[model samples]
Target: MASKFQGFPGMDDILPGEIEKWQWVEERARAFFEAGGFKEIRTPILEPTELFVRSIGQSSDIVHKEMFSFKDRGERDMTMRPEMTASVARAVIERGLLTQAKSLRLYYVGPMFRAERPQAGRKRQFHQIGAEIINENEASDFDAIALVHGLLHYTGLKEFSLNLNDLGDEESRKKVKTALADYFEKEKNRLCKDCRWRLEKNVLRIFDCKIAECQPVIEKAPWEQFAPLGANFRKLTAKLADYGIPCKVNRRLVRGLDYYNGVVFEITASGLGAQNAVAGGGRYDNLYQDLGGAAVPCTGFSIGFERLLTAIQAQDEKAFEEIRTRRVYLAPLEDCAAVLNVVRETALRLREKGFRIEMSPGVFSLSQHLKKADKLGARYALIAGLDEVSRGKLVVKDLAKREQAEIEPEKITACFEQ
Candidate 1:
C-alpha cells in the first residue's frame, strides 16, 4: 500500500548506511577544528527577522527571496537562518564574547533553512560545517582560506579548484555598485527578469545570474574596471602562493551573501557537476556594527556537508571501513535459558572492548547463522550452543578466513584482537 504521508520536498531522511558517512566527516572536522584552536559554538536555528535583514542586507537573495520567515503568536517577526555568519555575529555581540578577549575563533556544524528550488546537493534544509574568526585583520582572510584548504585535503578529495576574489573595501564597493547599476540599466532589456530586479536592488548580484540570455550582458559588464584590487588584496594572494596553495583569481566571485566586503572564495570539486562548490566564504568587516554592535573585522567559511560527502564517496571506495571494523555476529543455536545467558554475557564482554556485536534472537541452525553473519558484513561469528555453554567455551569462526576454533569464553575478545 502507498504511504499516507511523505517527507517535505527538499528535506531528506539520512538512512543507516548513508549516515555512517556523515559521522565520519563530522569526526574528522571536529578533530581538525579543535586542533586549530577554534571552539565549537551552536546558535539557535531561529532569530529575529531584523537580524538577517541588517546583517545579510535586505536586498540580498537570502533576505529578499529565500528566507523562511514567519510571525510568532507574540507578533514578533522571526526567521529560520539561511546561513550561520549573521547568527554567529549576533552571539558574539550579545554575549560580550569579544569584550573579554581581543579576538574569538569559533566553529559550528548544523542545519540551515532556505526556501529555494532544490536540486542535487541543494536542499531546503541543508547542513554546513563552518568557522568564524572575529576581530582579526587581513591575515585572518588568508587563515580562513587555508583552513578550508586543509579541511578538504584532510577529506581526501584530489580533484578540485579554488577560486578567489577581492571585493575591496566599502568605498570601492560603493563605486563599483554605482557603475554596475548604470551599466546594467542600459542593457536592462536583455537581462533576465531576476537580473532586472537585482539591478535596482543589488547590481553586483547580476553576476550570479545563471540565465543563458544574461550571460553575455553579465560577462561584458566591466568588473575589473570598477572593483579594482588594492595592496592588501594583492598581499593575500602572494601569501597563498608562498604557502603553495593553488588559487585562481576570479574577478566575478562575489558570493551570494551581501555582507561579504573583501576577499571572497569558492572551492569546487570534480564530481558535483554544476552544483560543485563544496565550500565558500569571505570577510564581512562591517556586519557587527550593522547589527548594533561594536565595529569588528571577521572572516570565515562553510563547507556544504552533503556535497563534501558526495565527493568523498565518489573518490574513496573504503571511506566507511573505519566505522565497520571488528564487527561480530553472535548466533545462539539453542532456545534454552543457559545458552541465552551465555550469549548475553559474551556479547556484553565483547562490547566493553569497543567491538560492535549483533546478537541473533530465536533459534537457527549453525549454517543458517553463518548466512546471517555474512549478510551483516560481520568479520567473525561467535557461536554459542548448549554444549559450549556447559564447558564455558564458544566456537569462534572467522568469516573472512573460513576457519573456526573452540576457545574459552574469556578469550573470545582476545581472539578478535589478534
Candidate 2:
C-alpha cells in the first residue's frame, strides 16, 4: 500500500462540516465593520523579513523566535507574516493610501503564519480578523476600543472581558523601561534564563514571562509609579464608562509586541485555556517611522479567529442553529441519463434566484436522497425524477415537516412560504 499523507502537525484543516461556523463569524465581522465606515484591506501573506524585525522589534518574541523566514531565488530575504499590522503599515506607505485620505479605517481577515509550538488551540497557521485606524490621534483610541466591543457583541459573543493598559508615550516608556530594568537588574540572579536575557535585551519582555519564578519580581515592580495612566488615558477610560463598555485596567496586560505605546488592550474569554485572549491591539505611533515612513499614529486590534469561534461555540452553539436556514438539498432520483440534466438545470435556476442549494453528484433513490438531505440539515429537498419531469412538476419534500408536494418550477418560492 502507498503511504498516506496528512496535514502538517501544527496546521488544522477547516473541514467542510465545520466551515459554516467560520463563515458565520466572518460574515458578522464584515457586516459590523462595513457599517462602521471601515473598508476591507487585503495584504500579501509574505513580506520582507526585515519589516517584522523593525516593526515588531528584534527583541520581541514574534520577530526573534516565531517568524517563518526564507530567502527567495533573487537572494532577497522574505518571511510569511506572523501578524498583519506590520504588513498593513507597509501597504499604507507603499501604495500611498494615506495620501488619498487623512485617515483610513481598514479591516482585514486572513491567515498568519507563525512557528509557535503546537498546542490545543495554537497552530503554526492561524487566522485573525483585525482593523486599523491610521493617522488618528489617541482620541481615536476610544473608537477602536468601542469598535472591538461592538464587533464582539454583533458577532454573538455573550461573555468576554476587556483589559486595558497604558504603555505611555515614547518618553514615558523610556522612563518606565529604566525603572523596570533597574528593578529587574537587582533580581537578576532570581530571573529565569529567558527573563535574564529579556532584562538585557528588552526589559519590558520580563513582564511577559510565564515562568512562575519570575512572577514575584515582576509583581513588585512599581509600574504605576513610573508609567501611570496619563490624563489622556484617564479620559479614554471615562469614555468607556460613558458608552457603557466595561473594562478592567490590567497593569500587567502589556502585549508581547514592542511597537505598542500609549493605550493597549486585550479581550479575553473563558473557554480558551491559559492563553484565553481572543483579541488584542494597541497604538503603535512609531511603527510607520520605524519602517521608512513618517510617524503615523495608528491604533488597531486583531481578533484570534480560532479563539473567537471557540469561545462563541462554548458559550452558545445556538448562534449557528440557523446556518442552514432556507437551504435546499437538490436530489436527482431518476435515471442518470434522462433526469440528471433537468435536475442540474433546476439547481442552477434556484441558485440564481438566491437559494442556498446542495446538489447530489449522482442519481440516488428517494430514501437515500432524503437521508443525505437530513444529514446535511437541509430544510427542504427538491426531488427530480423521470415521473416529475413527465408530469411537468417537481416534488418538494419538506425535510423537517415531513410533507411533500408536487409544484410547478416557477412556484418554487411557494413551497418555502410559511
Candidate 3:
C-alpha cells in the first residue's frame, strides 16, 4: 500500500454503527454540563507548538514524545493539541473573560492527538468531554467535585470509583520535593527510566508510573519522602471528606500535566484492563498566569468518551438498543422526482418535530425499499409512489407491527408525534 493511502497508524475511522454511541454520550454530557452552569467552548485543532511545552510540561511524555509536532509550509512551528486545558486557558486569558466576572465555567468536546501504540481504549487520536471552572474559591472546588460525582451517576456506570488527591500549594510542595529529592537521589539507580526523568521534571508524576517493573520499588518508597502538603491543602481535603466525597490520602495519584497544582484526581473501572484511567483532572492555579493571563485558579475533569463506552458495553449488553432504534427510514418507489420531493419535505418536517429520519432516494422497488427500512431497524417507513402522489397521500408502514395506513401528505409529520 502507498503511504498516501494509509492513515496514521493510531487513528481510527468512526464508521456509521460506531458513531451512535458517541452521539448519545455527547448529548448526555451537554445536558449535564448545562445544568452545572458550564458554557460550551470550541478551540482550533491546531495550536502553536510552545503551548504544550510550556503548559503540559516539556519533560512529560505528552510533550517530550507523544505530540504530533511539525513545521508548517511557511516554517512556523505548529502542533496538533494533545489536550484541551492549555488551549482553553490561553483563550480565557486572551479574551479577558476573567475581567468581566469573578469566575468562568466552560466545557469542551473534541478530538485530541497523541502518538502512541494503539491499545484497547487507547488511541493516538481520541475524543474527550472536558470542563474547566476558573477563578473559584473553596465552594468552586466542592462544586467541581459534586459535578463529577453527579456526571458519573448520570452516566449509568455501576462499577467505577473516583480516586482523589490533594497536591499542596507551591510553598508546601517545595518542602516536600526537597525531602523526596534526597531519597530519590540515593535510590536513583533503582528507579525506572521514566521515573528518573520525572524526578528532575515533576516528582509528583513518578507516583503515576504504570510500569510493572517499577511497582515493587515504588510500593516501598515513601511518597512523603518527595513532597508534603501545606496546612491549607490539608484543610481542603478535610472539607471534601465532610461533604461525603469519600476521598482518601492517595499519594500515588497524580496528574500527567504540569499545570496542575492542587486536588488532582481520576476515575477508574475494573474492566478497563491495564489502561484503567477512564477520566481525570485537577486544579491549575498557575495555568492562567503561566499562559499570559491574569492570575486565576481553576479546576475541572474530563471523561474519555471512547473508553467510557467500552466500559459500559462490557458491563451491559442491552445498553445500546435504545440509541440504535431512534430512526424512521423513508423509502420512495416510482415518481422519483415527486416522491423524492415528498421525502425531503417529510424529513424536514419530522426533524423539526425532533424525530430522526433516514432517506433512501435511489431505492426503487417497494419490496427492496421495505427491506432497507427493516435492515436499518426503522420504527416507521414513509412510503410514497406514483399511486400515492396521484392521490396526494402517503402510505405509512409500521415496520415494528407490520401494519400499513394511508394519510394525507400534509399530516405525515404527525404520525411519529403520537
> Candidate 1, residue 290: CA error in Å?
1.0
The all-Cα superposition gives candidate 3 an RMSD in Å to the true structure of 3.0
Worst 10 residues of 3 by lDDT: 224-233
Give all TM-scores, in the order shown: 0.87, 0.91, 0.89
Q: What is the number of backbone collisions in each predicted candidate, taken in the order shown?
A: 0, 0, 4
lDDT of 2 by residue, 1-418 (tens): 7759878978888987688778778988998999999999999988999999888888888887899999999999999999999999999999999899999999999999999899977899999999999999998999999999999888888899999999999998999999889888999999999988888888998888899998988888888888878999999999999999999998987899989999999999987889899999999999999899998999999999999888988889686776676679988876665567766777777776545677667778888988889888888899888888778888998877788999887677655655
lDDT of 2: 0.88
Candidate 2 residue 135 C-alpha distance from true site, Å: 1.1
What's the best-to-worst order under lDDT? 1, 2, 3
RMSD of each: 3.3, 2.6, 3.0
- lDDT for each residue of candidate 1 in 1-418, tens digit (9 for 90 to 100): 9999999999899996577568677878988999999999999999999999988877788888998999999999999999999999999999999989999999999999999889998899999999999999998988999999999888767778999998989998999999989998999999999888899889888888888999998888898888778888899889999999989999888999889998999999988878999999999999999888988999999999999988877777776676566688988889989988888888899988767776566789999999888887888898989998898889998888899999988888888787
Q: Compared with the true structure, what per-residue lDDT tens digits does model 3 show for residues 1-418? A: 5566867777988887678777777878889999877899999999999988999988787897899999999998999999999999888777878788888899999999998788887899999988899888545666777787777667765577777776677676777667766767787788899889988987666776888777776676676645555565577667778877666567777778888877788888766887877889888888878877777878888888788888777777777676545677887776567777887888788776656677665766888888888787787888888788778888988888889999987787766667
Q: Give the Cα error of residue 211 in candidate 3, in Å.
A: 1.9
Backbone clash tally (model 3):
4
Q: Each model's C-alpha lDDT? A: 0.89, 0.88, 0.80
